[model samples]
Target: MDSAVDGLVSQAARGLHLRVAQLISEVEQRLRCEVPALWEYPDARTSEYIAEHIGTILNGLEDGTRLGAIDPPAPEPGRTGQLAQYGIPVGAVLRAFRLGQGVILDRMLEEIPRRTNDPELVGAAARKLIEGANAYVDRISERGVVAFQEERDRRMQRRLSMVQEAGVRIGTTLDITRTAQELADLAAEYFADIVTVDLLDSELRRDGAPAEDPLLLRRVARRSVSEEPSASVAPQQLHTYPKGARPYRALITGQPSLHLLDMPDEPVRGSIPESEAGALRVHSMLVVPLSARGATLGVAQFFRCGASLQFNDDDLLLAQEIAARAAVAVDNARRYTHARATALALQRSLLPRRVPPQSAVDVACRYLPAGARSGVGGDWYDVIPLSGARVALVVGDVVGHGIRAAATMGRLRTAVRTLADIDLPPDELLTRLDDVVLRLSAEASIDTDGEAVEDAGTEGDIGATCLYAVYDPISHRCTLARAGHVLPSVVTRDGTVDLLDLPAGPPLGLGGLPFEAAEVELPEGSLLALYTDGLLEARDHDIDAGVARLRDALARPAASLDATCETVLDAMLPERPDDDVALLLARTRALGARQVATWDLNAEPAAVAGARSNVSEQLSIWGLEEFGFTAELVVSELVTNAIRYGRPPIRLRLIHDRTLMCEVSDASSTTPHQRRARVFEEGGRGLLLVAQLTRHWGTRHARRGKTVWAELGESVAFPQLALALPGWDSG
Candidate 1:
């Protein structure tokens, strides 16, 4: 559009090309050392740059310097002139390069036709320059960090591998002090300073309630071992930081930590620097958090100083890495220790939480753990209140009593509670428990043998001996099942101690063995003793002798259960348990001023009338006039079930105070199940009627027979039925 401008641009283009070749040579010559990597892109923008910046640059120079040799259109004279856009030259651009400046060159670049150029090609050149520069800087900084970490991790693993070797010995150990010392020595040597390791769980320290601070892990670790802690830190400080302090939060939280402190002369707040008076020389401290399943144990620290040698970044990184690995090791150890503790706690929970005081019927329970420190045995006892104002006293031993045994005891104890809650008879309760144990065993999940043996026994794998009995207040009858266990002593009020003659039954976990219960009259105030084989299996005595020893121990003229149980247990078991011992005792309560009678059953409808008459006579003898109100309904259901599905020979008993118990035995061992119904069903409603009419009902294992029992509550009748059944449904 402008001819003068066009000619000048043409001339300028001719001149600028000459100038750029010169400028490139000059840049390469002078700055080759500084930026040898910088390169130019071969784009159309390079042509425009040569025509513009190169021409102006040469014209700006005086006579014949390298750039001045080129022909360039002169800018308008005597005016502060900006070069015309198309005729910029090279000397100017060269000067800009010498100043390490790109602005002038950048402005000149913008005037070029960039849209038609490959932007990516240009950007690629730029990024290479940036990355090369950044790379140089990072090598000086983070490279050392990487090296430090690798070295530290290697050293840590090497040291801890030794500790793990020590751990092999440690697991079977009763003394942890030597193991603790060995670990501490490793830490101290690697850190090149004083390293102190404390037992996080010391048996000696009885801290109130359990410590809330997860960082306070000594309880889980050492409390089970020592009576008092030998090493400890100041309780973790809560006020170390205020709310809203960050990265600072990491300081308070249970994390492995290292601290740099400004210590001065004279100890101040337990953190005085080594230069202080009478202070042990400690300059820098490194702490590593030790935890498992997110529970933090005590912090272990390494303290060193730069008084003689400086601590470098290498040392810091190495220290941090080693501490990290150690934290993991500590976590694993804590898990093993806590698992032991948890197992012990469960074992204790099975016993009385606190000692029971003197009571009428004697009760004594002593739980002797087999091995204490490295491993613990599980054995426990309970004297529980039963339905119908009786007492259910039980003693049991999970076989091979260690962690697995302890855990099994917990499960079996829970099973007992569940069966009792449903109000099962003693023999059938054992059956249900046996089923559960067998199922657990078959699943092959029970890890007995301290998990030392991979193929440790099952619920069926490890059998247990348990004796369960219910002593009734009205009849003073002790009904019991001894499942392949020691015979408990029965001491009558006349000072006669007799070993209960037990009919053989398989141990608890052996499925489908016939177990018969032996019922005996307590003769008013007889004391019964139950115990695990740990007592009988002691080194000094054969089992028969242990039983004889128990017989005499029961005749010790003991007044309370605690003494009786202790006397029998201590007499039978050794001071150091060869195995675990579980003991339980109970004294009988004489007939509660009322008459009790039991009526046997037959399949004939005549049996129903006989049952009703039997209930009437016993209730009248007990002076319970209201027994007629509820006794008829309970007897009717049991008799009716016997008449229909039950194959003959049922027994009904009316005890004192109108406690009507009706038992119907059938050839079928298949226990009766209550079918939940829609209100119209008539036939399956007998159990429903019995359940509503009675306080509770249960079943007992008889030889080739099962006794389904129903009891009358409060001598009263239920107002109505969900479904009324035919009268002939009664036996």
Candidate 2:
């Protein structure tokens, strides 16, 4: 090129640089007309890019160097990459560059003819400017295309990775709220700036079908990338969207819908709160239905905020795919929650409503079910009032969870109460309960014809662990036995806490295993704690640590038994326990010598009259003159029976407690039978008459002898004689 042509090109380049702002404006206008997609960007942003392009061209012309020889601007590739991320097509970007190039070429060629009158020089400058402009446009266009493709591939990979992560992260637990939270967190981290998961209220509660017309939704989870809390709905909040709302429409149609909040036609004020709408005015939102197995479970909302790219068709599709995966998890959690709720209801119903009133101990108990993932397990505690003013404190835990475990627990509890009614020792009662469990396991395994069914070995095998303790206030002793259960703890009156030393028998359902009982004489006001293994194995499964913590908790002085129970739970249990726990705490009470009277009588018929006289004298002394006649009659019959059929060393004892009790014991293991008196026989009516006179009558066998006992109702005697009787008042 000639120096004159070069000088001309240089002059035009300087002139174009001087008018850069005007050039940018003209190029932007042309781009708006030719490449409408560029119009989506703000005017200032479009002008900034156009200014960079014009600057680069002018500098190359001033230096008189080839435009292709210089690298593009530092931000050129990134600018095009951003356009790709914003979902702009490469063709549209290349067209915008071409339009700006034409505008520059026209301005420079027009400036050449005005500056130089020579035809040769003007023609030479025009040709040079056109050549340089075309080279620059081609160079940047190639770079833009490469950048756009790379960005598109990178975004596609990210989306694919997010979908794969959703499979691993969501539905990790059988908890509806937790699953929803997992979905929201995953989406907010990768897919959107803000995400929310809302399910039908019925779906959350696992009740009824999804509502369509007026969608009743509960926000189960909400997540946002911003530090500031969203002005939208909160988690666990229940709200309803009207029929025409975007969320309602998506749920009704079972499809995803995208809304540009900045668009005038997409009014969001009526669909959402004004604050939320205002907050989202400059963003785009995607509402995707969480549908699984042909059922619409819920809806997920994704919001692009600040400078983030607006959601487009591909984004909506991705949101739908992610929501589809999450929907299956949510549905599974909903179904599992329904089953867990049913099992929990059954377990609670089968448990004791309230501890029965008894004078042996002041008791308080607590039962906690396992975490949602584990389902509801079988854990039960009962305070059964046995004969002789004694009470049984029992806690049992079945091996598995759900309805079967709960049912088995109920059956075992019933069996314990029945065995207790017979006044069996703790060891003997557990032995009987073990037999009951074995029978139950056997029955569960067999089919209708009494033949064993396939796959009935482990699934149908019933197993449990129980701790049964019988506390007698009269003797101030507690006899406790266990079938593979944690040892019971005792807090002595001196504030020392220790676990009782007892044999750890095999778990129930293991036939032929002998259970042993340990008898500990508890002082008045001593605390006894009976609990299942769950209480000791919940945290790290370190039973020693749990026992130490429990011992320390029990050692603390509490105002009441209920407070002690709370303290023990707070100390021994984690925020969420992994297993079922049943705790029973009892404070011992003693019946003083003044409340009981005993006599040793020989095995003679004459001892019956003396027994009757002695009972009358004791009743008068205890201010129970009102019950003299009934007591005398019951004592007469029991003593006569013991004298006739029993061995030597017969004994009679009377107890003044909640009820008046008379017991006659002899060195005979034979039990008496209550038979009807025929018209021909006069000898069978003594036991029958004794049963008719007392409120309750039964016989309990001991190792050395059998005791026949009867209890008189206190309704007629206690209230009238409470003030007159010394040391006979009910505590």
Candidate 3:
């Protein structure tokens, strides 16, 4: 080699070294820190572009350099080969280089070409280039590693703060959406962007839509991160998205759908957003799919650039951690919502509708459900209209509580309506009801789990206490019967009184016990109180005490019947609302402000005509019209029964209260019972048909022989309509 050529080569090499040194210094200045060992741009872009930038900085530095021959700064600072600082992150600063796999290809392109250069320098230079490239890569990788570690530290700290905040802000589990939002805000703060969480589904909610499931709102809350995320739903705006009906693209597809869109630069929509904000404008972005169990809550998207660059992987990972925290919060909210809706539905289902508007009588009623919850029980009341211008009042209870209890209540309601359609008196209706109860009991041990009492007496013993009564406008007679139900309280213009009908029979479904309807003349302007046991059963008082309290409240002056009932219940059953209660107040006022008379009698057939005349006279005296026809029919049935099956000197008595009552005295101790009328038999049909025609008729023993009686309801509107000729004085 010539001296001149060697000198020229040496000088050229020195100049190149000086240029690289100046370039490195310029890059460090631009980065606002040391370039951290060696650095290179991704290779997908022209290496020429990188060289150009490097050359520009280098030439400018060289133009101002005092030493053009100095060896380039010892081939980048030499300390530990890889980055060791935990606080500074590697990926944080080098994030853009990795996006879309640019960094991967960059490393490949940068190494292969340089390693392949030359024959004389082949092995030695190849090894040297490889080692040098490794060193450079190590430095670049260290920066990213530092950045990632720093991000991890920040995320952990944020999570700890969020947990502490959750403990302070929402101490317990209550309210849906409220605590969720609070936790959501905390998540947003932790990740410093849009953080969302959607919880999983459990037994109640099969899907995400509120309409698809009654209990779907339960189990929506924050979940831990150790669990894999599921598809979730999140409204882009305020409109809460239920979830995806098809194959969800997010972390979840069921209720509370969401995804972990943690990185600010990583648009959940997949593209580097091409909106007003450019894709590359991102400083950092994070995304995490919030999920729990198998449910996919929703996605959480975070954004991080003020005026800088795309978000890094560390940021995205942090967003995911934040979403995990939100999952727990959402669960609480959904559970609270489910509980509240269930309570409301149960209460509404067990109440009666508004009172029907009518002229025969003004009716108004109200039912206030017990505030406490014990599963769900059934207690119901009804005002059923019957044939022949009559109305029936009934109230009953099923024995258990909760959803099952409510279902039983529905069944009982259907049964009561069916019985009402037949228009049977309380007793006969009860007999049929017993059959129904027997059938139901045979099917299962527990009736319907609420107020539907379990039939424990035997196979045919399904039981419920009820009070059935009929009211007639013409007679102003309220015929009421008690089936092991509470005695009713009557408030008269004269004073308050307990109209305890002694003929009350056993509850329905109990050994087929019979029921007897008891009649009382509701003198004009009378108030009758009918109520369920819940009204009479309280924490501190027995049913008897409750009844007494009701009576006392009714006695108070200057109070309407409905008002009195309400007041009494309010005063007595105000606290500890654990039982079901129902109350119906009927005010039967004879519009005419009329007067009437009543009498007693003994069973006797010989007194038939006289009893009829007595009843007729009584009706005339009371200013009631056209009683002769009804009187004849009433006497015939009463006298016939007395003579054929009754015994003794019969005394006849008449009643002018509402119906024309014909009574006969007799010595016969056996009370009359009605058998099904036969087509061939002549006599049994008499009493049977008689009992069916009138609202009510019965026998009661006093001092002497028992009395057989019949009541012929006065048809006030059509007085001339016979429908029946003079009975020829009947039997």
Candidate 4:
């Protein structure tokens, strides 16, 4: 601390300034080669400038200037900004300056032996050199430290801004996979060279508890900063983490982990997948648990690979913040997924498992709900078998979506079947359905949310649209009526498509309006496509365009009704339909003359005897001798009743398809009801005998009057009729 000694040291430093500068320059040049930031500067001029700055500092030391006043300039004008731009940490800059000091001292030590053989001069000169180097290094480092702190503060501000942006950007939608991927993408953009997001199985399970094992985590999202093509696809997503893996450990501990791969002291080797571990040459990794509400839902891993800086405490904090926000979004999505699954199951249970087989129509159907945004809706189709080889093909749509709409759709379907069984015409059936809907809308309090509508007539209406059509193989005609439903497309036998010219009646539930029915003569082998409005109405196209698209798809019929149904859906339904779609396609097949037998009977009791004889003969010829006795008995009883209590113009007909159909028509409009006759009753037992002798029998009132029909199964093995066939069949 002697002033004279300091002055002597300063003079020696000035005289030796050039030697010190040369020695320091040599050391700096070597160190810059290893330091990333220094290597980025313009070639030899950078070294020369550094050397001159050192010489100026040595001259200041000789002149006895204060350490603060003597500034060692040389890292160019904006060293702080330059180092930061090159991603060089302030520590690296300070290390380079420290290396220059060692070189100056080492050069002075070598000069001590050559300066003189006198010990005093050698010792004094060496002390001055060491003191000067220490003072200069101390002063310059202070400046570097200040600059470094400033640069670090700026970086911290920028990272905070990025974190705020990520909060707003990530999990913007309630989708589990998307939100996870967003976290990975954001991390890869700013903090990491590679990112992966793995979620716990419990967070994805419908029960909200892990299936089989709760500790298993499934990788849901992954990303890499490099765009280089790799031989292997990224396994960051859709891969499982072992129970004891690093990600799993992070989840269990609910803590962030930082591992520097190059450090032997860090104990995280063999922690990740082998392939991923091998890919890390000079990398640092940080793993943080995506935890929320005290539950660890998943973990996020960020890797700084290649030349990127190692993972530090600040980086870990940012990653944990991102993972925290992402965890909440993922949890929300998981809950929504469970709700969606429940809704889908309800919809499936309400939908028909398979279309009922009909003798008149070969049917195929398809129903698809709208995308995730809409969840499940009330689009439905059904094939109900009407009496006499006629089938009612129906497609309906409820006004709303989700479980409520589906429940409403099921109710409407049941109502249609109930009305259809009564043998009402298509138009009349819809009229009654509208009444049912109006009542449903009024009684809306019942919340018939999940009742499988066995009797829709009793339930209140949810708003809906329906297109009901009845196809008769005998007449080769289909009678269709609509209530605010889309028109159907009919593909003729010649493969020509035409939209059915039917009136668009008001949708169901809106009462006071009458629905009209239109009949089209479908030729044999013709195709009939009935669909709900969802098929013909979408955001991209109006009903007209949709019909046109459908017409084009069905222009040339496919090989089978199933194929045609698929083709129509593939063409008419958009990739992501905006609404639920229900389609029903049927191919018409007429009953040939060989399949039907008809007869006209006189309006007299004696005519019954002749009708029985004719039915017996036809059954024998058609190889239905097993049912000949039953047929004769049915014909006798039907004819006698038509003649005894009915008007004139009586007729009998028999259809042999899957079953034997015996129909008797008369001019009387009275409907026959089956009643339990007293043990002594004779005449009332006629209808009762017909009912017991056949599988089913019903009376349908026609335009002219009425037709009482009975259908018997193929095999009738019971004893002969006890009534002896109304005194006509002694044969």
Local distance difference test, each candidate: 0.54, 0.83, 0.52, 0.76
User: Which ranges of candidate 4 are over 4 A from the true structure?
Assistant: 1-59, 72-153, 160-179, 207-211, 225-246, 253-279, 291-296, 328-345, 439-461, 640-649, 667-670, 680-688, 719-731
Over 1-731, each residue of candidate 2 has an lDDT whose tens digit, in order, gives 57878888888787778888888888888888888876574422666777777787788878876554655678998899888776778888988888887888898888887787899889977877777677778888888888899999998998898889999999898888899899889888886877778898876665565454466788888876656665446667877877778888888888789886666224543324455545545378898999988888888888876666787777887888888989999999888888888889999998999888788999999988888767789899999987778888998999999888988888888899889888898999999999999899989998889888898888568999999998889988888899998888888889998889999899999889799998889989998999988888865759888888888899988899999999988988887788988999999998888999999997888878888889999999999998998789779988998888888789899989888999988889999998865665657767776666678899888768888999998644333432333332346
Task: Give the per-residue lDDT of model 3 (tens digit) for 315-355.
Answer: 44544444555555445455445653574376566556566
Q: Judged by lDDT, which candidate is best?
A: 2
- Model 1 / residue 472 / CA error / Å: 6.4
Kindly provide the TM-score of model 3 when superposed on the true structure, using C-alpha atoms.
0.50
In candidate 1, what are the lDDT values of residues 1-731, reduced to their tens digit?
A: 23332233334334444456655544344434443322221111333432443445434422222222332323211000111111123233333244322322332233222322545534543343234223422332233344334545564575566555544533343333444444445555545354544334422133335643332233122111112323233222222223322222333475544454455222122222223312444445554444335554444445554442223334445545554445445555445556667777777866567533322255656777765442556466766654445667778777764567788787887788777666567788888888987887765543454343355543347577678887777666778887777788777778888888877778887888867887887766677777777777766778888777777787887657777777777677666667767776676655454445666677788777777777777667667768675777677777777677767556565555335555666776667788765645556766776787777887655557776777666646444553344343333
Better of 2 and 4 by TM-score: 2
- Model 3: residue 519 alpha-carbon error in angstroms: 16
Please count the clashing residue pairs in each candidate, in the order shown. Answer: 35, 0, 99, 4
Question: What's model 1's overall lDDT?
Answer: 0.54
- Candidate 4 lDDT, 55-95, residue by residue in tens: 77666766876433666775643565546544567787778
lDDT score at residue 420, model 4, on the 0-100 scale: 91
Q: All predictions: root-mean-square deviation over Cα? A: 20.3, 7.2, 11.7, 7.9
Candidate 2 vs 3: which has more lDDT: 2
